[model samples]
Target: MTTLPTRTDKKLGLVIDLDICVGCHACVTSCKEWNTGGYSAPLTDYDPYGADPDGAWLNRVHTYEIANDHFTGTVHFPRSCLHCEDAACVTVCPTGASYKRAEDGIVLVNPDTCIGCKLCSWACPYGAREYDHDQGVMKKCTLCVDRIYNETLPEEDRTPACVRACPTGARAFGDLGDPDSTVSQSVNDRGGFDLMAEMGYKPVNKYLPPRKGTDRAPVTNVAPAPEQTGSPIEKLFAWADRALSR
Candidate 1:
């Protein structure tokens, strides 16, 4: 089994805001696009155009209809590797293929050393691991390690592809170990929480809970436009006028 680092200086991870994710799937698509050609290349799609299609993806978004006595709404959850402090995936690897970086706390699989055992995938609690059928190896989100630390890219564009592609700015990446970091402070102020904390994996990534109704005005509260009051030809002219104003 692989041994994990006793400590990591930087807990680099994501802060996902469930409140405004919008289920756009932008992050998922961008992640697949970037990684499929980068560090974890050739993310194969089996029978892509056939009846029974399957593929490997690093990130995925799920939509859930959350309901209870006090709250009711749809939640868009974007899930990927949480980069846990006590990563079961890393510890379970018979080869040293699975390992966590001591410098950044980012868990990764070395494809060259991996033997496609799938033990790491089975050990992960969050279901973040992906099995590359073509390569016969376990694959997962590297937090765009190739991009994040690449000095070639502009400083502002050095975040994970998912974070960069989020249309609503729902995903964030930073050093969670530093209390003063923007990501850490956002988590602290917004009551961010870990997924399945009882599992004891101690995930580095945090999720900001969906805000309650009282916290903001409900979408249903917005009044619809009043019915247009005018003759048929006048209404046509009015509609054209409105369209032209833009």
Candidate 2:
């Protein structure tokens, strides 16, 4: 039997490719499905068809319109628990259920150890953690730790369902510690930026910025027609040109 190496040191995390994301909500839906069935308590929806349906979700996608004087467009910002390097959620947990993995650097809540106190949610700025009312525990993204290391699953299918389900291929899962990894290279080459950088969360995930058109395409005015000094037919053509220009 092949043994899996323990993720010693900070394996780092992800580099979400915002450029490729199409805001399809595949990741969101897939995450809900996986977490709902895999964990002790799957996601639950309250009044799903009622006046105000609400449910617990560890991940969400937000859409925003950003524009300057000359350009206008929409940016789809996917939000989830960043799994911060200095996660306050871990410290705030009185029962020690919320902990960060020293091996891979993933922040997780052990349902067995959790005491149902939502202090971890209070400490989170991104609102990534969700309270599981059924199990009286806190739930958040595990980065598919159980699936990734499962020997029964195929190697290619070991990643989180969100990463696998993303139709646009916006999400990536790998060791950010490896400088040469695709995630790290994308961050370095495209200049990835963090959301709410002032918070100093030091999120393991890096968000790639949206792209824009080049500045080389310039707009110019057409020259006016010369004074007409020919037959009425020729003069009419010049007048039409001037009118079209105006």
Candidate 3:
């Protein structure tokens, strides 16, 4: 079994705002595009052109219709690796292929050492790990380890691809360890919270809940009639783009 670092100097992670996300999947698309050719090259597609098309993806977005006395509406929830401080995937790896970085607290897998055991995937509670059938190895978000520290790319482009591509500026990346950092301050101001704190994995990523306001529409169980003018995909994207304007 593997072991986690007792402490990391920096805890670099993401703080996602649920209110701002529009379920656009722009982050999902950009994550796939960059990581497919990036540090984890060839994210793997099985029968892509055939009817049973499947591939490994590092990021995903899900939408939920939520309601309460405060606010009621659709909220776009993006899910990915939380990069827990006590990462079960890292500790469960038999071959030591999975490990969390001491320098910045980024959890990662060494594909060359991985034997495709899927142990790490099972250990992860967030379902962040993806098993690539073609490579026979577990994969997950790297926090764009290759890009964040790279000197060649413009300083502005060095963050994770998901953070860079979010159309609504819903996602932010920075050191959560530093109290003075902007990310930390945002957490303080917005009441950002852990995903599953009771589980005790001490996840690094935080989520800001949808804000409560009188401007929000009343909760409704009925689905809206579809707009007949455009394709379903077009309508969805169009809706996602417009959702935040309210």
**Model 3 clash tally, residue pairs:** 0
User: How does each model score on lDDT?
Assistant: 0.93, 0.79, 0.92
Q: Which regions of candidate 1 deviate over 4 angstroms?
A: 218-246
Best-fitting candidate, scored by lDDT: 1
**CA lDDT, candidate 3, residue 215:** 59
The lDDT, on a scale of 0 to 1, for candidate 1 is 0.93
Error of 3 at 78 (Å): 0.5
Give the best candidate by TM-score: 1
**Candidate 3 residues 1-246, lDDT tens each?**
268999999999999999899999999989999999988777998898999989999899999999898778899999999999989999989998899999999999888888989988888888898999899888899999999999999999999999999989999999999999989999999999998798899999999989986556687689899757778898898899899676
Put the candidates in TM-score order, highest first.
1, 3, 2
Question: Which stretches in model 2 have alpha-carbon errors above 4 Å?
Answer: 1-8, 68-71, 215-246
TM-score of 2: 0.80
- In candidate 1, position 156 carries an lDDT of 82
Give the clashing residue pairs of candidate 1, or none.
Answer: none
Model 1 lDDT per residue over 1-26, tens place: 37889999999999999988999999
Residue 73 lDDT in model 2? 73
